[model samples]
Target: MKLIHAINDLTATHKDLLGLSKQKTEALTNNKLDEFQALLLEEQKLIRQLEKQEKKRQEVVEAWNEEQEYSVDSLTITEILQRLDGEEQKMAEDAAITLTDTITELKRQEQLNKALLEESMKFVQLSMELVNPSIKSMNYGAASSDKLSGRSLFDSKA
Candidate 1:
């Protein structure tokens, strides 16, 4: 029961994170830096909550293993499912599957956000370059004798 509760909490937190992931995509797409920053802070909070839930779940699983005379060092969710039966098993299975799907979608959305951010950065860089073009170095190959030296582009007398 405790294990079931923990999984449910974890899944709920992950679903919240997925919702934020979609909002982050929108914020990034619309170039809303403030919203993006706020979303990041909220995501951090949810991640911390998720970690706590996961720890609780692991502890419950370990305790269950100890009671069942099984190894407490490592156990997969599937193994946990095997130990459970009836409604508990069904609920846990469904929650686990939903959590997995949500996490997968979140990852895909995060990747898309990353690419959008990269493109935005590139756009900003190009814009800055256009506004303030860099001065090119005049140094030429040693083998080439043609040299403008320190001469200005236009005669100063003009």
Candidate 2:
């Protein structure tokens, strides 16, 4: 019973995470840095909560195995599915599928968000380079300007 409950909680939390991931993508795409930062905090909280719930779910499985006089040392998903029966079994199966699908969606969204962020960072760096031209330049020349014409004034090995 507790295991089912934990699975349900995990499923719900994952659903929340999936939603947050979508929101994060939107925030990044729209260049809403404030919203994106806020979502990052929310993401951390959900991830921490999910970790706790996952631990609880594993403990519940161990407890159930003990209750049913089964060896808990080598507990696997197949073994757990066989232990569960009736509606509980169906619910657990559905939750597992939902968990997988939602996780996949989250990953896709995260990748897109990462691409957007990388592009934005590249743009920022480009702008900075343009504004501060010397940031990417190397002047390995003599102190006198008269000696500069034949030497390299830029960042190059030539």
Candidate 3:
């Protein structure tokens, strides 16, 4: 029963993570640095809370195993579910599946966000290149100064 609740909580937290991922994509797309930073902080807090919940679930499972005189090592959720019966078993299975699906979706959203950030960075780099073209160094005759100067692509190509 407690494991069921823990899985439910895990699913909820990851759903929140998915939402944050989407919001992060929006922030990056719209160039909202302040909102992006704030969302990242909130994302960190939620991740910490999710970790604590996982630990709490682990403690509960260990306590259950100890009371049953079972070895705690190598225990899977299926083993825990086997200990349950009737509606409790169904609830546990549903919660487990939901949690797994939610985590998968969260990962997909995270990947999408990462790609967006990468593309945004590439766009910024290209923009900078257009604004301040890189200098191609070339030595002049001995009478000329040693320093080489930059030229915009348009100017040099023309």
Candidate 4:
């Protein structure tokens, strides 16, 4: 359905935007200038994928409309019915396959977007942990040691 296709496209766009925003936010917080640039490039790639899907969807819609408009002009009612039935069946099969493929692709994109979001969140958390002054204070012993050993400040308490 055209409505379904439109909805899917909109959903994909929304997810892509959300993922991109999360990535940008995480990059800023983490002070990872190189990662930030890479994220920007990835966002562009997602935009291009969305555009390509939209174009394919439009083509499907146009083909579907044209198929529906086609008429089988025949002198005999039987011949006309046969032709119409064949055309309808063919169109139905094609539409079904196209719709299924479109939905699958959309679902895959959604999953990818979700994964990207999760990765962004992880990056944000990692950045926060790295930059948080309190964390250093909490591991004061390690910070004080010139060797940068893994021992925590709490090690003495144990």
Clashing pairs in 3: none
**Candidate 1 C-alpha lDDT tens digits along 78-104:** 988998889989988988898888889
Task: Give the Å error, residue 81, model 3.
Answer: 2.0
Task: Please give the TM-score that candidate 1 achieves against the real structure.
Answer: 0.83
Tens digits of per-residue lDDT for model 4, 37-143: 89878878877887887677666555654666755332232332234456554554454455556556656655765676687789889899878757445755533
For 33-85, candidate 2 gives per-residue lDDT tens digits of 89989999999999999999999998888888888997669687667888789
lDDT of all predictions: 0.85, 0.83, 0.85, 0.60
Q: For model 2, what is the alpha-carbon lDDT of residue 91?
A: 79
Winner on lDDT (2 vs 4): 2
For model 1, the superposed segments whose C-alpha errors exceed 4 Å read 137-158
Q: Please count the clashing residue pairs in each candidate, in the order shown.
A: 0, 0, 0, 0
Q: Write the per-residue lDDT of candidate 3 for residues 1-158, one digit (tens) a residue.
A: 67778889889999999899889989988999899999999999999999999998888788878887887685798998888899998999999999999999888888888898899889999999888876543434443433324543355542
State the TM-score for model 2. Answer: 0.80
What is the descending TM-score order?
A: 1, 3, 2, 4
Say which candidate scores most in TM-score: 1
Give per-residue lDDT, candidate 1, residue 40.
97
